[model samples]
Target: MRKRALDTVFALAQQDERVVYIGSDVGQGTLQGFQESIPERFFVEAISEAYVIGMAAGMAMTGFVPYVNTIATFLTRRCLDQIAVDLCIGNHPVRLVANGGGLVYAPLGPTHEAIEDIALMRCLPNMTVLVPCDAEEMERAVRASLDWSGPIYIRIARGGESVVSLPERGFFIGKAIEVRQGEKLLIATTGVMLQTALEVQDIMARAGYNLGIVHFHTVKPLDTAWLANQLGPYSHVASLEEHSVIGGLGSALAEWLCENGDHKLKRFGIPDRFADRFGNQAKLLSYFGLDAASIAKELQAWVKPS
Candidate 1:
């Protein structure tokens, strides 16, 4: 997804001179083709995330659409002030293309993990938060966001995520897509967890229970009207995300449910505390009960009472 977004940025810059790429100490050869093709518009500055954001804001002020790229934690946890004051407050058309969202860097530890990035970005006004599930969807989101006003926080995994998103659903910035239908349980998720949710859907189907899948690539500015309609048919709901349970998709749905309806909501995500041990992303997901089998077990246990 990260590769596709940057590639799309280059593709967009080809037609529109306003589109530019900015990065803060990313890996070698990250966008070499982009830099070679458009040397003036491309930038791979020093490892200063905050400074990069401030610079991007200045560039945006001058009518240049800067797509700022960096590690997710550095972009959000380290550069929140610049992002809020420079971009969100000014309503700049900057795209914060974050890498290593969630536990993609589990091998690197908690400091690198971006479990609270959604909580940080969504709280800011004039910031459009997006977490596209696949490479195809990343292209769609990046292309669609060109004309949109204000800053956009696009959280993406390292690379090679499952290609689960469909073009037939018709991607939108602030809308939810109902990917699959079910009878009783509804799994509302975001990011790469859509693949886990889809697997859990099939698992439950094999167990003689039908579960639906709804993908929310756009976390903030959530499709509330669409969500309200979806909850009526299912007896229970599960919000699966690669973020914290405190202020992610679960919290967003909980806020809507507070004043609107009386529905059962089960939030499937990382606990409030940081990770203690680590391996690969799959290991961490299993530890958090976010894998397909663990999620299936949770669904069975969560729905057995009703």
Candidate 2:
């Protein structure tokens, strides 16, 4: 997904002269093609994340769409003030292409995890938080991001994710995708959780419970209209994400559902604590009860399997 996103930035630059690439300590080979092809527009800076946001803001003001690439934690945690002041305040068209979102760097410990990044990016007034489900969706988001107004935060997941999204459903910045429809339960997921939701859906199916899925790639502009309509038939609704339970897709749904509906939402995500263990992404996911088996077990506690 990271490759697809960065490669798409170069593809966009090829078509639009206004597009520029900015990398922050992402190694020399990062976006190498873009740097070689458009050396004048490519910039590889040091570990100055705040400076990157300010630079992108300035470039945006000059009518250039600057796409900044870096780790998710640094992009949000280290540069929140700059992002809010320089990008969100001015409503620049700078694209924050964040890599290793939501624990992709779990082997590196909590410091590398972007568990709270969604909340940080979502709080900004003009910042649009987008978490694509896979590489294809990431590519689509990149292309769709070319014209969207305001600062956009594109969350990139680990590579080699499942392909649950389809071109037929189409890609829109604010619209959610309906992966499947069910009668008993509806599982709303964002980013890499779509595939896990699908696995859980099938798990519940074997136990005689029907489950539906709504892929919420866009978290900021919650697709309330479509989501509101989709929840009517299901007896249960839930949100599954790879981010922290707070201030992410789960919290966003709670804020909207609390006022508008009576459905009790079951949120499945990382708890409100920092990660202390070290392992691969899959190990961390299993340890956090985000794997399909564990998620299904939790779901069964609420709704009887059979």
Candidate 3:
């Protein structure tokens, strides 16, 4: 997914002279094609994440669209001031391609984990938060970011996630895609959690429960119209994300529900506590009760037989 998004940025650079690629302490051969093709526009800097963000903001002011790539934690947590003051304040069109979102770096421990990235990015003004489910969706998000008006934060997962998004339904920024249609219950999700939601949907189906699924790739500037419309018919609405329960997709839904409707909502995400254990991504997800089986079990408890 990360490679595909970077490739899209390279392709966009080929077509647009205003496009630039900046990396902060990345691997030696990272975006090598972009460097070789457009040496003047490519920048590889050291461990200075704040400096990189300030530089990207300055380039945006100069009418250049800069795509900054780095670890998710460094981009969101390390450069919060620069992101808030430089990018969000002015509404720059800088594309932040964040790698290792959620628990993708679980083996590297909590410092490397980006569990709060969504919440952090969503709180900033003029920041568009996106969590693509797979490489295909990542390509679409990257392509769309080229024309998007403000600072865009694209949260990328570890590669080889299942492709749950269909091309036929099409991809649109700030639009929710309904992957499955049913009644009584709605399962709204973002990022790679869509895959787990789909699995849970199938499990519930086999057990005689119909689960509807909505995929929200674009978190901020959320598809409220779709959510508001779809949520009305269901008796229960649940939000699933690979992020914290606070200030993420689930929280966003909760906030919306308070203003719009009186629907019952169950949020499934990491608790508001640091994951102090070291393990693979899959293990950590299961440990946090985000695996498909655990999600299905939770759903079975929430939506009882009529």
User: Which tens-of-lDDT digit does each residue in 1-306 have in candidate 1?
Assistant: 888998999999999999989999888998889899999999999988889999999999999999999899999999999999999998999999999999999999999999999999999999999998999999999998888888999998758887988888878899999998776788999999998998898788877787888899999889997877777678788899999999999999999888887778899999999999889999998999889999998898878522
Q: Tens digit of lDDT per residue, candidate 2, span 168-209? A: 988998999999988767899999999999999888998888
- True-structure RMSD, every candidate: 1.2, 1.0, 0.9
Model 3 alpha-carbon drift over 4 Å, by segment: none
lDDT of 3 at 187: 92
TM-scores, all candidates, are 0.97, 0.98, 0.98
Give each model's whole-structure lDDT: 0.90, 0.91, 0.92
- Residue-pair clashes, model 2: 0
Global fold similarity of model 1 (TM-score): 0.97
Query: What's the ranking of the predictions by lDDT, best on top?
Result: 3, 2, 1
**Model 1's lDDT to the true fold?**
0.90
Residue 66's lDDT within candidate 3 is 97
What is the RMSD, in Å, between candidate 3 and the native fold over all Cα?
0.9
- Two-way lDDT contest, 1 vs 3, winner: 3
Clashing pairs in 2: none
Per-residue error (Å), model 1, residue 85: 0.7
Residue 54's lDDT within candidate 1 is 93
